[model samples]
Target: MPLSREKIAATAIRLADAHGLDGLSLRKIAKELGVGPMRLYDYVTNRSELLDLMVDVVYARIADVGQHSEWRSTVLTIAQATREAALEHEWFADLLGGRPHLGPHALAVGEANAAALSEAPAVRGIDDLQRALGALNAFIIGAVRREVTERRTARSAGTDEAAFQASLGPYLTGMLKTGRYPTIARLVIDGAHLNAEETFNHNLALVLDGITSRPRT
Candidate 1:
């Protein structure tokens, strides 16, 4: 009921979700909370701090992939959970990888991941662990960005995935007929049409495998 940092972040997130980050302002959050804009500064210093709080709130939603039987499974679970959270909070994808998240909740997620990987035989030291985590984070962030962008494109065009592809069919057909892009043509014609979830899982498994299979340094 009372104003709090969490409440402010939550309101900002909700506003961002409904509209977008471009127009998210402290004034909007204050009005949403039925308070004056200056009052919001008591909880959040500025837009940057507000963004940090929003990201932390989203990270808090990530399910704890606590202590799995194997490090790979732990990493996989965490990655999947992160992706799920980002998808739910679409603005999260845009903010992710933009800055270091040192908030309690964000640190907890990172700590849980580091602890699990540290116990693994493949993780020789801090460097290896950092590398592994970095790789996963990079992939997850990039993948989420791409997926959300596609979703936005479809929404803006008022078309579903299938229809969107159909709309591009004519241009693609002409490009493919040139015979200069044999490999790309083959991919467009034969690539597996995995849904977003399947596509993410499939690529994620490959990334995990690559990470674990690297020679111990």
Candidate 2:
């Protein structure tokens, strides 16, 4: 059977999800697909192009942001969907925002997000809507990246976040006793919410509140 770009991208996504981005390569993908490594070039020019395709394929999975009735809902939905995708594909958080993904699906998602914001009563013009979208994207990507990174670190350490933090307790105690970082020390001593989902939702709500509360200029 002949290979198509979509098939190539899909296979790459699976490989990435299974082995992580660092473990993914054309050679491995071709081996998994039962094809020659050189044959992949017929579809994607190189690794960079293949990476771009994978990013788009992942972005395509996000439900249309404009489908929601309200801008706030749409933004929240998109943010949640993005976080879900990143969690499902651990490599996704790293690749996101690393490059411009101008693929069809990516562009469509962008359009949907912008359109949803444009319809918001608070958004006065194209500029405001664009800024709102940008701010939302920035927050989602940053938050998810941190979440994914911590998860990955915990996995590597052969424990969950709470256990990992517990392992660091001695060092943290010493550092806190110095009183060099009072706020961080307070958070550590007072205990903070370690639940990724709750943290994401809480921060997302704060971001949305900021966006909506901004006075229309």
Task: Rate residue 216 of model 2 by lDDT.
Answer: 55
lDDT at residue 83 of model 1 (Cα atoms): 84
Instruction: Please name the candidate that would achieve the greatest TM-score relative to the true structure.
Output: 1
Over the stretch 81-200, how does candidate 2's per-residue lDDT look in tens digits?
Answer: 889999999898998887888988888888778887787666788788878878888888899999899888898999998898789999989988997999998798887656789888
Query: What is the lDDT, from 0 to 100, of the residue 195 in candidate 1?
Result: 92
| Tens-digit lDDT string for candidate 1 (1-217) | 3899978888899999898899799999999999989998888888999998888887777735554877778777888888888778788888888889988889988888888767656678889888878887888999989998888898899998778878999999999999999999989999866699888998988877777678864
Tell me model 1's lDDT, rounded to 2 decimals: 0.84
Per-model C-alpha RMSD: 1.6, 1.7
Candidate 2: C-alpha RMSD to true structure equals: 1.7
**C-alpha lDDT (0 to 100) for residue 12 of candidate 2:** 90
Model 1 segments more than 4 A misplaced: 63-65
Off by over 4 Å in 2: 64-66
TM-score on alpha carbons, each prediction: 0.93, 0.92
lDDT of 2: 0.85
